[model samples]
Target: MNAFLKFMKRNYKIVALVVLLAGALFGFTMIPGQKENDPDKDKLLIELLTYVIEKGHYNPAAIDDTFSKGVYKDYLENIDPSKRFFTQADINEFSKYETQLDDQINNRDLSFFYLTYGRLQQRIKEANSFYKDILAKPFDFKADESFNTDYEKMPFAKDDAELRDRWRKQLKLSVLSSVADKEKMQDAPAEDKLKDKEKGFSDEKALEAKPGADVNKTKANGEKKSFTELEKEARESTLKSLNDYFDFVGDLKQEEWFSIYMNAIAERFDPHTYYFAPDDKDKFDTSMRGSLEGIGARLQKKNDFVEISELIPGGPAWRGKELEQGDLIMKVAQGKDQPVDISGMRLDDVVKKIKGPKGTEVRLTVKKVDGSVKTIAITREVVEIEETYAKSSIVKKGGKTYGVIYLPKFYIDFENQDNRDAAKDVAAEVDHLKAQGVDGIVMDLRDNGGGSLKTVVDIAGLFIEKGPVVQVRSRAEDGKPSDKPEVLTDNDPKVHYDGPLVVLINNFSASASEIFAAAIQDYNRGLILGSKQSYGKGTVQNIIDLNRFVRGSTFGNLGALKTTTQKFYRINGGSTQREGVKSDIIMPDKYSYIEIGERDSDNALPWDKIAQAPYKPFKNNFAPAIANSKKRIAESAEFKLMDENAKFLSERKDDNNYSLNIDKFKADAAKIEVAAKKFKALGKYNSNLTFDALPYEKEKFKNDPALAEKKKDWYESLGKDAYVNEALNVLDDLQPKGGKTASTEAKKETRIKTR
Candidate 1:
C-alpha cells in the first residue's frame, strides 16, 4: 500500500465518525422545515458544483461560498460515487445532511463563484452577439484592416463616438471581405471556380503565359520579358490565391471559429498552456511526450509574420544546415513545385499547411538574414535533439580539471521506454567523469525550465544521502491534511563523487531544477552560483478524468482537466513559491533587464513553510572560497569585459527605439562595433595575453563562436569560473587553511598589478 493509503486508514476513522454525527444532526432538520423549492435550480447547482470540485481539486469548503449544501451533496454524488477519497461508510454518515440540505443552503455564500460564473456568461453572450451580427451582415475585410491595425488601442478609445468609429472601420473591412469574394468568383476560371478543384495554371508560370505574352527581347546577357503580359498574369495569379483563401475559410465550422476565439484568450495567458480540441489532443500528447514528426523547428508569430524561432539542434532543419534564425518563410510546398504564398496569413493556417505525416517532403522558400532567397527541402521525421540533453566537457586550469555538465532542460522521454532518461543519463555522465579523475564538477542548470518530478527527486538523491526530498500538501477536504510528504528514493547508496561541486542556475531555472538546487543548498552539498533567484513554480498539477463527473447514465468525455492539486515545500518547511532558490554567488546576465522569476508574475502563490525534516549537511565551508573568488574576478580582465558587455546589452534593451534612416542606422551600428572591439581588446590585455584577436573577429563573432567558446571556458574553469571562482574563494575562507596555493598566490599578484 502507498503512504497515502496508510495515512488514510490510520486517521480517517476518527474524522469519519465526527462527520457522521454532523450529518445526523443536519438530516433531522430536513424533516421538520417545509418550504417550496426550485427542484431544477438545486439540480443545476449540484451538477455544476460537483463537476468543478472533483475535477478542480480545490477545497470542498470552497463550495459553501459558491453553492448550497444540497447542491454540494449532489456534486459529491456525481463526482465521487465510488468514494475513492472518502469511503462508502463516510458517505452514508453524510446522507443525513440531504434531509437538512435546505437549511444548510441558507448558510451558503457563493460570491466568488457567482462572479466567475457571471464573467463566463458575459463572454458567451458577447460572443453570441458578435456571431449574430456577423451572420446578418458578414464582415467587410477591407474596412476591418484599418481598425484591426489599431485594434489594440480600441480598448482605450474613451468615448462611444471613438468606439463606434472603430466599429465602423471594422464593418467596412467585413464588407470588403464580401466584395473580395465576389471579385474572386467573377475572375476565377470555370473549372477552377469550384472550391474543391485547384487552378490548372502554376502561379509563376501563369504570369509568363498570358495573352499577348512577349518573348524575351534578349538572352541571359541582357534579357527582358513582356511587362504587359507579366502584369496580366500576375493579376490572374493573385485572383486564384484569393479564391483558394475563400474556399479554405468557407469550410471552417462553428466549433472551429469558437476554437479560434478561445485560443486567442488562452494565448493571452501564456505561450505554453493551450486548450486543445479533440482533434488536436493527439498532437498535444505527442508534444508533451517530446516526440513529433515535423521539420524539427519551433515557430512563432512575430509582428504578424510567422518566423522560425528555434531550429531543433539535431533535427532535419538543423541537419540540412539551410534553415536559420531570422529566416522568413514565404511559402511551403509538398514537393518540387511552385509554392503557395503564405505571406499575410494567419499563424494557425500556416501551421496547418506545414504539418504533415512522417516521410512526407516539405519545401520551404526562405528569405535569409542577408537578403538572399533559397528553397530548402526537408523530409519530416521524428527529431531527437541530444543537444538539449545534459552534456559534459572537461575544463583544465592550473593542472586540475573540472567536469562541466550543461543541462539545458530537465527533459525525459516518457513515451519511449527504450530512450535514455535524463536523470539516469546525467548519473552515468557523473560516473564517467568520476572515473576520468576530475577534481570537481560544475552542473550548469541555467535556462532549464524543469520536467518530471520523479526525475528531479532522483537527481537530488544523487547529491545527498537518502532522506525526504520534498513535502507536498494538498488542501484538506474535511479539516485534515489530504496527504503526507512523499519520500522519494535514490536506492543506490554509493556517492557518485566526494569532491567539491558547483551548481550554476539563472532566472530561467525552474520547477524540478529549482527543487534539485534547493535540495543541494538545504543539505550544503554544493556551491550554488548564478542569478539572484530562479523561476518559482511550486504547485503540482494532476490530470483528472472528467468522465467520472458526468450527470447522465453513460459516461461522456469532456476532456481531462489539469488542475493544481497540491503545494510542494522543501523538507525544511520553506515553500519555493514567490521566492525561488537564491544563489550563493551572483553573475551578471543580459536578461537582467527583463523582470523574471515568480515574484515578477501576477497571481503567483505566496511562499510559506510547514515543518522541517531530519537530514545531514555536507561538510564543506564555502564562504572564504567566495571572498577570494570575488577578489580575483574584480581584477580579471575577461570578467571586467563581460561585465561591460552585459551593461551595454542592458542599455540597448532599455533604448530600443531606433531611427530607420540609413545614415543613422549606420552610425548606430558603428558605435556598437567600436564598443565590442574595446571589450575584446580588454580581454586580450588582461588574461591569456597570447590569445589571438583573429578568433574574436567580426565574421567569427557574427556566428557566435566567441560567445560559445567563452561559455565553454567559463564552465571548465570550475573554481576559476568568475562566479565559481568567487565560490571557491569563499570555501577557502570557511576552511581552516586560507588561500595558500601557488595558483592562488599568482592570482593575488595579478589582482594587485591590475589594480
Candidate 2:
C-alpha cells in the first residue's frame, strides 16, 4: 500500500474525501468485509486466489503496488486489445487507481472495478452512437485517408469528436474487403443467373434480402452494384456485426468481469498460472476429451470472423477434404435450417452450432484463403482420440521404406488411466513399424504442444537404455531452488526401435515435445530437424480445485487454478524455459520468422541452467547426415522458396500501416495476393516420397471406401511434404546401405549452441 500512502501524502484532503465517499457507497462497511449484492463467497474467492497464488505459484511476484501496476496494465489491455474503445479522458480517470489496486485487492475492495465498469458501459454507449452516426452519412471513397492497425503505436482519442473520427476511419477500413469484392462484381462478365438463380442457395448463408428480390441479382444482370448500394450493404453489415458483438457482451455478468480482474492479478505470477471458472473448466474438459461429435475443426476468433485453425484428421471435415485450415467460417446451418451468420458470434457459441449428435448434417459457409466463399456440408461423427494419437505410415524413397509417425500432442486422460497415453501408444506404434521392416524412423512432432510429464519419461525411455531425461526444480521460501532437483528418468533398459532416427520438430513443438526432443539432442540419440527451435515451455502446472481448499460454504462451483509449480531442465543443465530445443539441421517454414514460442508470452519465466543431471550419452552418426541435409536444403528450390515465403510473411506482419484510401488499399491487396501465390507453390511441392498405411489400417479401410480415400489423401500429402523428404534423406545419410543403428560407434561430446 506504498502507493496509497504516497497518494495520500500528496493530496491528503482529496484522498480522505474520496475514501469517505467510497466507504459510504460500499455499504458503509468499516471492515471492508461485505458489500451490497456481493456475497461472502466472492470475498472468500478473492482471499483464496491471493493465498494460492502466493503460496502455490512456482515463483510468485511480490503482491505490492509494482505487482498492482502489472495487474492494472493486464486488465486494461485485455479489455482494450486494439485501443479502440477507451479514450484518453477515460484512461486518465482510471489511472487514478493504477497504484492503489494492490491495497484495494488486499482490502477486498471492488469499488475500482465498479467505477471502471460503469465508465466502460458509458463509453460503449457513446461508441455505438459514434459508428451509427458515421454510417448514416455517405463515406467519400475518393478521400485520402489511412488507418494504422498497429494499435500499440496509436494514441487514445483526445475527445469525443476525435473518437468519432477514429471510429469512422476504422469502419472504412473494415468495409474495404466488401468494397473490393463489389468492385470485382462490377468488373465480372454477366452470368446465366436465369438458369441457376437461387437454385443452389437453399442451404446458403442466411441473407437479409428484400422480399421477391433476387439474391443473385448482380450475377443475373449486366448492371454492376452501384457505389451507394455497396455502401449501404457494407454499413448495414457493420451495424449488424456491432449489434451482435454488443449482444454477446451484454450476456456476460459482473462475475465474469471480476474473474478477468482476478486473473489479471494471478497472471502477475506467471502466464500459465490461470484461474478457470466452472464454465471454463467444462470447456477445457471438453477440449481435452479428444473426441466429440462435431465437424472437427478448431476455430479461433480473428476479429469478427471465426477462422478454422486446424482440421482434426479422420474427422468429418478432414474426410470431406473440402474444408481446409485458414478458412473463415461465416455461417453455420443444421439439417437444412436457414443458415445463421456466425460472424461476431462467441467462439463457444459457434462451436455449439457446429457440433451435434453423431450422423447429423451440418453446413458451413466459409471464406477460403483465396478470398472466395464456399458452402461445405459434412455428416458429423464422433472424432476419435486415435486420430490425434500416434499413427505410423511407411514412406518409401529409393527402394527403402522408412517409418513416419506424427504425434499431434502428448495426450493423456486425466480421468482415466486406462485411456491411451502418448508414450505407451507411440512405443506400440514403433513395434508395429518395426514389424513392417522399416529401415529408419522419422517421428513428426510438429505442432505437438505436449502432455503428461510421466509420459515424457516413458517415451524418452523407448529410445534410450536408462538415464535421467529431465530435472524438475521448484521455487522455495528462499530466492533459490527450495526443493532438491528431482531427476525424472526411465530405469527400463530395453530400447525400442533402436534404428537410424530422425525426429521432426517445428516452432510449435512444445512442453513434453521439447522434453523428448531435448533428451534426444542431449544424448545425441537422433537428428533433430525443422524450425530453428521448438516451443520453449519447460514449466509444469498442477490444477488445484479451489473447492477442496474451502469447507461448509453455500457457494457452488469454486472452480480450479492451473498454477505453474515447477520448471523442467534438460540433462545438460539448460532449462527449456525459453530457448527451447535447438534443431541440428534447421529448415525454413511459415513460422520460422514468427514470434510464436513461449518467449513471446507476457510474464513468461526466464531461461536458466541448473547442475547437469548425470547420464550416459548415446552415440549417433548425425554429423555427416546434418551436413548433407544442410547442403540439400541450401540447394533445393523448394527450400529457397520456403525461405522467401517466411521473409515475405514477416515483412507483411511488420507492415501494419494500412491505407484507408481505395487506390492504396487496392494496390496493397494486389501485392499481398501476388505474394500469397508464391507461398502456394510450397504446398504443391512434391518430393516423390510414397506413403502407405499400416497393414491393419489397410485391411480395415478395404471394407470402407470413404475411409480409404481419406487415408489415401493423407498419405499423398505426406508424399508432398518436402520437409519429410529431407528428413528421410538425412536418415539415409546417417544409415548407409545396411540401414542399421550407429549406437556401437564411439561416444563424442557435442555442445549445442545456445540462443
Candidate 3:
C-alpha cells in the first residue's frame, strides 16, 4: 500500500488559487500541436514547477549550490543505482554541472539533462555487450574474493578495462549465488526439494531448462551435475536474467527518464513532494480512491518472469483462489484467445495486458509454487483493496471480549464522500463492537503512513466528546508559518464508544497517524501503546493539477505536482515533525534501536511547537495499566528475546561485505542463521487469544469464502502477536472498577504526560 502525507480536500482550493495566480503571472500557456519530446514542454515544466513550489510549498528550499548538488547526486544515483555503467570519465564530465544546475534551472536550460541522457544511453549499450561476454563462460568462484556492496561509496571505474572488470565481478556474484543454491538443491532431500519450489523456476529463467537445450530438465533435475556443469548452467541462467533486464531497460522512453529528473528536483524540497507523470497521476488517484477496475493481483518482475507479489483480498484473483503469491506468470490472453508470452517484457506493459474493463475475462498461464504450470481465467472487476480499509476482529481473552480494529491507512474518496472511508468504516466497526458487548477496543495503527487529515479528526471524534482534534498551520505568502494555527475540532459532542481504549502504533505509523495517536494521548482517552514512537511526518501535502494552469495547451498532459502546503500540530501544541508521538507503554521491537521515520530522511521538515488548543482531558486514568504493561514486558522472556534480537539487528545493520568464495559465503550465512535462530521463538509465540469476525461479518462469509479466508488468516496472525496480547492485558487493567463511566478520581491519579 502507498502512504502519503495528504491534506483534506477543503485545503486544495487555497493551494490551487495560489498556483493559478502564479501561472497567470508567469504566462505558461503553450502552442497547440507540439511534437513529442518537445524541448518547449521541458522548459515549460521547469518554469511551472519552480513557480508552483515557490508559491505553494510550506518551506521552499533555496535554489543554490547545495540544492544543485543534491539534485546532481540523486539524479545520477537514480539512473545507475548499482554503480554499473557511467565510468569515471563520464562522472568527471558530468561533475561540471554539479554546481551549475541551479543556474541552468533558473534559465530553463537542458544542457545538463541532454548531456547526461545521451551519455547514459551510450554507456547502457556498452554495458549490455559487457554482460553478454562476461557470462559467456563459467565464473571461478573458488577465488577467495569479497564484493563490497556499498555502491554509494564504491569508486567508479577509471577506464573501459576497469568498467569491464566491474561488470565481471557483479555478474560473477550473481552466478556464484545461483550455482551455490543449485548445488545445495541437488544435495537436499526430496522433501526439502519439494519445499524449495516456492522459490520458483520459470522457463525463461534459463536456456538450459528449455526442451531442446543440451542440458534438459530431466537430466538437470535427476542427475547431480559436476561443479563445471552446474557453473555452466548458472552462467546461462545469469545470462538470461541480464538479457531480460537490459530488454526492460531498453523500453524506457525519454519521458520516463525526464520524470526521474523532475522528481530529483522536486524531492529537494522534501522527501514527500513529488512530480507525478500523467500515468502515475492516474495511479495515485486510483490508490487514494482505494479501488481499481481490473484484475486485482500485484505483479513484480522476478528475473525474466512477472511474478504475483500479492492478491488483493476480496478481489477477483483472490476470490478465484487459483493465483497465489510467488506464482510466476508466463503468458496472458483474452477470453478464448491464444496466450501471448510475456517473457522479458516490461512490467508496465505486462500489467496493461493483464488489466481490463470489469466483466472481461483474462486467462493467465502461471507456474505455480509447486513448479507445475496451469492456465487460470479470472474475471476483471472493481477491486477494492480490502486491506486498505478498516477491519475489526473480536478478541476473546480472560472471559472478556475486546475488539481489535486494524487501519492500514486513513483512506477516503475525496470525489465521493458517501463512499466508504476510514473514518466512516471505523465508526461503523466501533458500533459493531459495541453491539457485540466488547468491553474494550484496540485501534491498530501499526505501519500506517497517513492519509486524509479530515479522516483522522473524524476518527478521533469517535473516541472522545467534542474537542479540538488537531491544529494545522498553513504557510504564509512569505514562506513562513501563519500567526494563528487553525484548530480542527470535532463538532459532535456524542462519544461513540467510551469504553477502555488503546491505540497501537509503531515507528512506521506516520502523519495522520501521529495526529490521531497524539489526540488520544493528549485527551487521556487512551493509552498509546507500541514502539518508542510513531513516524514523525507532521507536514501536509496537496496535489495541484499542473495542466490546469496552462490554458489551451496540447503539450500532452502536464501531469500533477504534490507539494507540502501545511504543517499540522498535536492539539497539545507540539509538531510531530521529527518527533513523532511518544508511546505511553513502549514495547520491544526490531526498529526500536534503529533510526527510521522522518528524522532519518535528509530533507524532512523540522519539529516545532504552536499554541496548545483548549480542550479538557477525559477523566480516565491509564497509569495502572501502563505500569502493569511495563512490568509484564520487563519480566517476560519473550520480550527479553525480542530486545536482544533488536540489539543484534542494530549491530549488523551495516554489514555489507560478502565473500565470493562458496565455502566462506556458506559459513557466514550459517553463522547468521545460528545467531538468528536465538530469536526464532518470537515467531512461534502464541498469546492464547482467540480472534474471530463479528456475527455480521461471519454471516457474509457463506456467500464469499474469500472474506472467510482473509479473516481466518488475520485471526491466526493475531494469535501469534505478543504485542496484541500485551495490549489486551493493558485493556484488562484499564477496565473501570464501577462501570464504563466510573470515576477514577480517587485512584491516586498517575498520568503519562504528552508534549
Worst 10 residues of 3 by lDDT: 206-215
- lDDT tens digits, residues 613-688, model 2? 8886765656788888899999999999888877776666556566767887778777766766766676677777
The order by descending lDDT is: 3, 2, 1
Better of 1 and 2 by TM-score: 2
lDDT of 1 by residue, 343-429 (tens): 435556677767778887777766443333445677887765545566666544455555667676666766896786888878877
List where candidate 1 sits over 4 angstroms from the true fold: 1-50, 53-55, 58-253, 256-274, 287-382, 385-389, 408-419, 479-484, 489-493, 551-557, 631-755
* Residue 682 alpha-carbon offset, candidate 1, angstroms: 13
Residue pairs of candidate 2 with colliding backbone atoms:
none
Which is the winner by lDDT between candidate 1 and candidate 3?
3
Which segments of model 3 are wrong by more than 4 Å? Answer: 1-10, 26-33, 199-221, 283-388, 414-417, 552-554, 701-706, 739-755
* RMSD of each predicted structure: 15.4, 9.6, 7.0
Clashes of each: 31, 0, 0
Writing each residue's lDDT as its tens digit, candidate 3 over 580-660 gives: 999999999877777766887787888898889998886675677888999999999999999998887766655656677
